[model samples]
Target: MSKICEICGRKPHAGNQISHSAKKSTRWWHPNIQKVRVKLPDGRVKRMKICTRCLKAGKVQKAVS
Candidate 1:
């Protein structure tokens, strides 16, 4: 499964990792994605990949049993 936010359409971020010896290596900073049960507009609960930021911002409503 891909680490992408379904609500915000966020993807992984590419960057370089530097060591103490000044050596650079390629690395990716992935977003905090989680599979949450979301409540749709029709009151149906479905699992989706969502990011923490969007969850905190109330972009999607979580289904609570």
Candidate 2:
């Protein structure tokens, strides 16, 4: 699965992890991506990978039963 947010274009970011001994290691911070069915402008429901922030912010309408 692609780890990218379709709406916000969010993806994994590079960072570092520090240990108790102050040793740093490379790490990747992934966004909270979810597979959801979105209601498009033309009233079409399509599945997409969206981030939690976009979902919470109502950036796209969700397809509800």
Candidate 3:
């Protein structure tokens, strides 16, 4: 599966894991994405990969049929 959201353009982010001992380790943060259907401007439904934040934020208009 693709590690990117087609709708929100969300992708993996790089960061570090901090430990109590003041140690740091490399880590990756990926967006919460899902495969869903959404309505388009033409009133047609289509399947697309979108991030969960967008869904929760009501950025996506309609689900694909």
Candidate 4:
């Protein structure tokens, strides 16, 4: 699967890691994602990949049915 959050569309960020010796290396920062079943507008449950921020912020509603 792609390294992207379906809810927030967050993707991996590329950057560099600096060492004490002044050496730099490529690095990537990926968002924390989780798959969950959420309630839709039509009252249907659907599985989607969401980020931790959204989950913690109560942006996603869990499907009851």
Candidate 5:
């Protein structure tokens, strides 16, 4: 699964991690993406990778287990 939100288009952000000694280390802030099944406009359920924020915001309807 890709690290992208199908609903909000959220992607991984690059940044640095600062240590106590003022040392900087490169890192990535990846979104909390999950594979889920969403209902499409045509009533077809499709699987996609979406971030937790979008899921919490109800941007897409998750498929019933």
Candidate 6:
């Protein structure tokens, strides 16, 4: 799946992993995204990749299982 959130547009962020020995390595920080059924304003439900943060914040209408 794509490493991008369809709701918030959150994507993988570039960062560094620092070791205890002062060594750094390139790494990617990705959001916790899940494929969920979302309800749209037009009363259409569609599957989309949404981050957990948006779910917690109630930014979009989630389809009932």
For TM-score, the strongest prediction is 2
Candidate 3, RMSD to the unseen true structure: 1.7
Tens-digit lDDT string for candidate 5 (1-65): 67988788889889999999999999999899998899887889999998899889888998786
Q: Per-residue lDDT of 4-47 in model 6, one digit per residue for the tens?
A: 99888999999889999989999989999998899999999999
Off by over 4 Å in 6: none
Model 3, residue 8: distance off in Å is: 2.3
Task: Compose the digit string of candidate 2's lDDT tens values, residues 1-65.
Answer: 89999998999999889999999999999999999999999999999999999999999999997
Weakest 10 consecutive residues of candidate 4 by summed lDDT: 1-10
Candidate 5 residues lying further than 4 Å off, grouped into runs, are none
Report the C-alpha displacement of residue 34, candidate 6, in angstroms: 0.6
Put down candidate 1 lDDT per residue, 1-65, tens digits, no spaces.
89999988999989999999999999999999999999999999999999999999999999998
TM-score of each: 0.89, 0.94, 0.80, 0.89, 0.89, 0.92
Which residue runs of candidate 2 sit more than 4 Å off their true CA positions? Answer: none
In the range 1-65, model 4's lDDT, one tens digit per residue, is 67688778999999999999989999999998888899988988899988899889888897874
Full-model lDDT for every candidate: 0.95, 0.95, 0.84, 0.87, 0.88, 0.92
**What digit string (tens of lDDT, one per residue) describes model 3 on residues 1-65?**
88798876889999999999989999999998788888887988888888898888888776634
* CA displacement after TM-score superposition, residue 43 of candidate 3 (Å): 2.0
TM-score of 4: 0.89
lDDT value, candidate 5, whole model: 0.88
Shift of residue 25 alpha carbon in model 5, Å: 1.3
Cα error, candidate 6, residue 23 (Å): 1.0
